[model samples]
Target: MKNESQIFGIRAVIEAINSGKTIDKLFIQKGLTGELSKELMDLLKKGNISFSYVPIEKLNRLTRKNHQGVVAHIAPIAFHNLENLTLKVIESGETPLFLILDQLSDVRNFGAIIRTAECTGVHGIIIQKKGGAPVSADTVKTSAGAIFKIPICKVDHIKDAMFYLQASGIQIVAATEKASCPIYDIDLTPPTAIVMGSEGKGISNSVLKITDHMAKLPMYGEIASLNVSVACGVFLYESIRQRL
Candidate 1:
C-alpha cells in the first residue's frame, strides 16, 4: 500500500477488476441513467464489487475527463483473504488481533488507525469494500509507511467478514457509542478483532448483529464522542496493555 497512483474512468476500472487488481471502491454519479451505467452496475453486483452512488458534483471533483460518470480508486495494497490470514495467525501460535472498519471514510483516521494496529501487532485489518476510505497518498503519509507493512482485507460486506472471523474463533468486539460496557472492562487476551465505525454514524446495524462484545470509551466531557482515530487508539492500546 506504500506506492501512490491514480485510476480513473469506467472501462479502465472494469479492466482493472478483471485483471485482478484490488480496487477500493467505485463511485458512480447518483442519477446516471443509460445502458452503459446499467451494465456497469450489473457487473459490479456480479463481481461483488462495492460502489457508491454519489452526486455528479462528487464525480466532477475527482476528474475533469469524460469520466463516463464513473470512477474507481485502487487500493494502495493488495488485500489478503480473511481465511488465509486468520489461519496463518493461528498456525503461528499467535493470538489474532484484527481491526475492522465498518464504514470509516476519513483517510487520515484510517491511516492513523492502521499505524496503531501495526505497532500493536495486529494480525490483519478488515474493511468493507464500499463506504471506507481509499488508501491514497494522504493515507500513506498519515501512516508514515505503516500501510505498506500491515495486511488489509477488503470484504464485500462487513457483516459477512465479522461472521467469518467469528467462525475462525476470533471474538468480535465493537467499539461503539451505544455500549454500556467500557473498553477497559473487556478481556482482550483472546483472539479478538475490534470493530470501529464512521464518524457520522457508529457501527452499522448489520455489523452490530454479529459482535460478541460491545465496548465503549468512558467520556465525561460535554462532547458526546471521541474522534474515530482517537477512539481506535484507546481501544487498541487497551488490548496491547492487556496482552503485555
Candidate 2:
C-alpha cells in the first residue's frame, strides 16, 4: 500500500475515523482486542464502516510499522450518500445515471469499471461496503485516476440500495448472463441505474428480483461469459450510446 493510501496503527485509524475520514477498507489482526481496540470496533460498527480480520502476517505485508492490530486504507475519492446524490441529480434537471456494482471484489475490475463509468458520464457508482473491492492504490492506478473523478457510494446492502434507487424514481437495469434481453434494446435515456454483478457470482437473487430491467450482451464465442469489467464497459457504453 502506498503511504498516502493507508493509515497504520490502531490509534491513528481511530483518529481518522473520528475525523470522518473516508476509509475504503479496513483490516484488523485476527483475534485483536484491547480496551482501545474494542472502542474502535464499536465506533466502526456504529458508523457502518466495513472491516475484516486478517492474519498478522498480512498486516506485516502491508506495512512494517506497528499497526497494533488494525490498518485502514484511505478511499481514493470521497464517498457520496446515495439518497442525497440521487435526489440532487434529479433536482438539477438531469437524467440520473448511476452504476451499481454488486460484490465485484476484484480491485482491478472495480477500477476498470469506474474508468468506463467516468467515460460514459455515469453520475455515480454504488457498491456494498463489505463485499466490493477495496479502493487501494492499485485500484486508483488501474482506474487511470478516474476514481478521483467519480462519486462512489458504499451501502450496507445491495438489495437495500436497489430498493432505494427504485423508490427514487430511477429504473434499475441489471446485467446478468441469465437474462434473455440484449443490452442495446433497453431504454437507457430514462432516469436509470445499472447494476453489474460480481466476477465470481452474478448479482444476488434478492437484488435481481427487484430489477426494473435485465439485460445481456450478445455472445458469439464458445466461452459463455465475459469478464466482469468488459461486461460493465459494454453495459455503460450502450447506455451512453442510447442516450446520445
Candidate 3:
C-alpha cells in the first residue's frame, strides 16, 4: 500500500532528504534504532526537518512495505518563499490580497479555503510549517487543482509573516467572533492580508494583538459561529466587493 506522495524505509527517506526533497511530514517508530536510523536522525537534525515518534502500528498503517520504522510524506507541491513572493507581488503593481492561515488543521477546510482564495484573487497564501494541514493528494483533489494555481508559502512563524506583511504596507485583518465590529464596517480597499484561525480556536490572542482590525461576520441565527471555510469566503468576498 504505497501512496504516491509517501516514501517509506529509513534508507529511502534519508535519500529523499539528501536529494533536497521537501518532506511534508515524517513518522518514526518509537524506540527505532540502527546505524541507518542514526544516520537519518542526524540528517533530519542537520536539516531541521521535523518528525514525530509514533508507534510501529502507525507506520504499518501508513505503508504495508517494510518501513524500517520510518515513513515520510513528500510535499505534493513546492512551497513558495514568503519574503520573495511578497516582494514580487508588491513589485507587480497589483494591490496585494494575501491569505494567512493560523494553524488551520482541517484538510477539507484548508482545501476549500484555497479554492475560495484562488477564486477571490488572493495574491498568495501563507501557512505555518507546523500544526497546519498538509498539502497532500487529498488537498490537491479537494482544491480541484486550484492548489497548483495559487502560490502557497510555508513559514516558521505566522506572527513573523504578519509583521513582514505589515511592514510591506499590507493591513492585517483577522476574522474572529470576538470582534466588536462587523466585517462590512472594515475598509478593505488597501493592500490587505486576511487571517483565518483554526477550527476550534477562532484566533489566538497573540495573533489578534497585532492585527490592524478584527471583524466578525453578522450572524442572525442561534448558531454563533460559521464553518471556517464558509467564513473565509465571506471575508474574502467582502474584500473583493470593497475593492470593486
Candidate 4:
C-alpha cells in the first residue's frame, strides 16, 4: 500500500475529506485563531473525522511548510467497502476468512495481526474507523510490509460490518477469555470471521451480542490472559488447523 498523500492546507484537507478520500488521520495544530481554521474544524466535526490536536512542533516535523496549522495523512491502503470486499471473497472460489479487530489500538498488535492474517490467508480484515490504529509508519514497519498485501476494510461501525458479514453467510466468532467454548472446539473450516478485541477490554457487548459463536483460548497458567496479538495468532492458526 502506498503511503497516504499529505495535504497541508486546512482547506485542501477539508476538501479531500469532503470528496470521499479516506484520510488516515488528521493533525490539527492546537489553538488556532483563524476563520478558515474554524471552518475546517466545523467540517471535521460534521463529518466525524478522527484527528489529533497537536502542538505546532509536530506539524513542523511532518513538513517544513507553513502548514496553516493543519495536515491530513491520507490512508496508505485504499480501503474497500465491507460489503464489496465480502462479496468479492464469496465469488473468489475460496472460503472467506476475515479478522475483525474490535477497538484494538496498539500499532504493534495491529501489525502483528495483519501479519498472521496474511500468512493464514484471511480474505480481508474489518476494523472500526475510529478506535483502530491508523496505518502509520510504525504500523507498516511492525507489519514487516504485510499491511501492503492484505485487504483492510474500514467501517463506520463494528456492528454494521458484522451484519454484512453474517448476511453474506460468514460466521462471526468472537475470541475472548469469557467464551464457554474453547477455540479448538469450534469448527473454523467454514467461511468464518473472527473478532478480536482491544487489550484493555474484550469484545464490546454490542458486538458480542451479534456473534454466531464465542470461543476462548484454553489456558492453564497463572496469568489468565494472553497478549492480544498472541491470542489472535492462536485463533487464526486454529482456523488454519481446522481447515486442513
Candidate 5:
C-alpha cells in the first residue's frame, strides 16, 4: 500500500530533497549500504534532515513496494522560515503571537494545539525539526483543517528560535508546572511566544531559563497535570483574555 505523502526508494527520496520537499519523517533500513544510499545520506546531512534507522521489517510495514532501504514521509504543508516569518509578522504591525512546541511527541496533541493556535489568532507555530511529532495526514485530520490555515516554522533548535524571538522584541513565555506564577498573572499583551513542552516532560530547563516568564495553570484535582493540548488551550485563551 502506498501512502499518499510517502516517497520510497533512495533515488526518489534524494530527488524529493533536492526539489525542496520537506520530509516530515524518514525511515532507513539498518545497515543499508550502497552508492545510492550514500548519496541520500550526503543529501540528508547537507539539508540537516533527520532519519531513523529501522529494521527492514519496519520498512516493509511502511510500504509493500520496493523502497531500496529508504522511505520518507513528505510534509503535508510547507514550513515557514522562522526569521522570514517573524520579520514579516513584525513588519505587518500585528502583535506577534507565536506558539513554540518544545519537542512535543504526540500527533493528536500536536493537532489539537495547531487547531487551537489557529482559532486563537496565533501568527505562527514553531516546532523543532527533530524530537517532535511530524505533520502527517493524521495531524491534518485531527486539526480539522486548521493546520493549513496557519504558518508553521521548523527550527534546528528551540533555544535558537527563542533567542531569535527575543531579539525580534518578542517575549518568550513558557508554560510549566515548575513555575512560581499562575497564567493569569502574566501580561501577554505584548508580542509574545508561548512555549509548551512535551506531554511527559514539561518545558526543558535550558529553555525555561531563557524565557521571560514561566506560568502554570492552578491545579485543584488529584491529577496535577492536564493534557498538553488542554493546557495549551488554557494558556492561549488566557493570552486572548488578557489582550482583550
Candidate 6:
C-alpha cells in the first residue's frame, strides 16, 4: 500500500482530489506538459488549491518511486471551517479564543503550539496555506496527538482571516518584541485571536498593521528573543490565568 502521508503519480493525485482528500500542497515537475498534466493543473485551479512547478530533481528527491511528475502532501487531519467554528463558539456563549499561526514552517513549533492551544481550550487554530508547516507525521507525534483534538483551519491568507474575525467582534492581538506593552497587559479575555509570527521574520507587515493590539513578552536575559513555541505557551497561559 502507498504511504498515507504522500500521494504520488498523476493519476493517483487526480483521484485523491476527486475523492476529497485533504491535500496540503502539490509539487509538479517544471515544464511538464501533456494531457494528464494539463488536466491536473486545471483541476487544481478550479479547486483554488495552490501548486508549484519545480525541477524533476526536486520531485525525485521527495520520492524514489515513480511520481509521474507530481507529488501531493496530504494533511494529517481534515481542516475545520473557520466561519462555522467562529459562529458556533459565539452561539455557545463562549468567548472565542483562536490561535493564528502566521507562516510558521517548523513542525515541532507548530505541534507544540497545537498542544498548548488544546490544553488552554482555544476554540481553533488557523494557519496560512502557503508557508505554514504541513501537518505530517512528525507534527502529529510532537503534538502528542493534540493535533487530532483541536480544530485547525487552513486559510489562503492570514490577513483575510483576520478581517473576518475582526468583523465578528474578535480582537486581533499580535505577540511581537517591538510592542511597548507586555503580552500580560493585553486584555486577552475578550473574544480574541492571538497572532504569533514565525521565528525568523516575525509577523508580516500587512497583518501587523491591522491588529487591534500589539504586545510583547518580557525579556531579561541577554538573548532578546524566545522560541516561537515557548513564546506561544507564555501568551496562552497568561490568557488562561486572566480568564480564570
Best by lDDT: 5
Cα-based lDDT at residue 174, candidate 6 = 96
Off by over 4 Å in 2: 1-4, 55-61
Q: Which one wins by lDDT: 4 or 5?
A: 5
Question: Arrange candidates by lDDT, highest first: which order?
Answer: 5, 3, 6, 2, 4, 1
Please provide, for model 3 over 139-182, each residue's C-alpha lDDT reduced to its tens digit, 9 standing for 90 to 100.
88889999999999988899999999999999999999999999
What tens digits encode model 4's per-residue C-alpha lDDT throughout 87-192?
Answer: 8889888999999999999888888889989999988888887767777777787889999999998888999999988888999999988899899789988899
2 or 5, greater by lDDT:
5
Once superposed on the true structure, which residue ranges of model 5 sit more than 4 Å away at CA? 55-57
Worst 10 residues of 1 by lDDT: 1-10
Q: At residue 30, what lDDT does model 4 achieve?
A: 89
Per-model root-mean-square deviation over C-alphas? 3.3, 2.0, 1.7, 3.9, 1.7, 1.6
| lDDT, model 3 | 0.93
Q: Which residue pairs collide in model 5, if any?
A: none
- Whole-model Cα lDDT of every candidate shown, in order: 0.85, 0.88, 0.93, 0.87, 0.93, 0.92
How well does candidate 3 score on lDDT at residue 23? 93
Score every model by TM-score: 0.86, 0.91, 0.93, 0.83, 0.93, 0.96
Candidate 1 Cα misplacement greater than 4 A, ranges: 1-4, 18-20, 29-47, 53-55
State the lDDT at 10 in candidate 6: 95
List model 2 lDDT by residue over 1-244, tens digit each. 4578789988899899888788888999999878989999899889878789899999999998888888888876788898888888889998999999988888899889889999988999998888678888778999999999988888988889889988888999999988888988889988899999988888889989999989999999999999999988888888778878
Which tens-of-lDDT digit does each residue in 44-163 have in candidate 5?
Answer: 898888889999999999899999899889998999999999999999998999999998999989999999999999999999887899998889999999999999999889999999
Clash tally, candidates in order: 1, 0, 0, 0, 0, 0
What is the lDDT for 237 in model 1?
93
Question: Evaluated with TM-score, which candidate comes out highest?
Answer: 6
Candidate 4 deviant stretches above 4 angstroms: 1-9, 15-21, 27-71
Residue 15, model 6: Cα distance from true site in angstroms? 1.1
Order the numbered candidates by TM-score, best leading: 6, 5, 3, 2, 1, 4
**Candidate 4 lDDT:** 0.87
In model 5, the Cα lDDT at residue 85 comes to: 95
